[model samples]
Target: MNATRIGAGDRPRLYVSTTDTTDVTGDLDYIAIEHAINGEPVSLTTAEKVYTAQLLDSRGLTPTAIGRLIGSDPVTIRGWKTNGWQPAPTGRPHKASEAGRERAA
Candidate 1:
């Protein structure tokens, strides 16, 4: 991961400001979303997605909202919740990397 990439746990829930017209956290998320929508190479790892999914779930955001933010569907988000946000096995064996580490191919 890049040193500057926003990790899933990095930002707090966006709060309305009393005087300012801007919410930094929300702005950052929007920027990321725009970049992704523009077909940029920004990608979140599965672990990152899991962390964010759990965070959003805890914040009471519905599956649709969380899915829009995280670039997944409501079904997948619900499945992650059912599995406790841990990566559930797909029942297929993982491929071995050149370093002999098992990873999704």
Candidate 2:
């Protein structure tokens, strides 16, 4: 599935209203994605993820740079780019805390 555009007059970004793990039957609005970079676990709403990806893209920041900015893996950041803010696929199993964030609802 592709992304859905967010509100107007805000930074242009796209979010997944449905995903591989989520569909119209569920509402995941309260769920937040967190990634520990350095020491802090940065929390981000789905919109934040989209904005983040676009922000980095607009600035021409590579995945390495964006990974450091959000405390995620560079490969994961690249996954976000390809997945378009759905979730950063680590290409490996995620820890318990890292689950759910991979797919937005």
The superposed Cα distance between candidate 1 and the true structure at residue 11, in angstroms, equals 13
TM-score of 1: 0.48
User: What lDDT would each prediction earn against the true structure?
Assistant: 0.61, 0.52
lDDT of 2 by residue, 73-92 (tens): 77766767788666754378
Instruction: Work out the TM-score per prediction.
Output: 0.48, 0.38
Give model 2's TM-score versus the native structure. Answer: 0.38
Score residue 20 of candidate 2 by CA lDDT.
36
> Where is model 1 poorest over a 10-residue stretch in terms of lDDT?
30-39
Alpha-carbon RMSD to native, per candidate: 13.8, 15.6
Model 2 residue 43 CA deviation in Å? 4.2
* lDDT (tens digit, per residue) of candidate 1 on 61-103: 8988877776888998899899878767878665555437534
Query: Can you list the residue pairs that collide in candidate 1?
Result: none
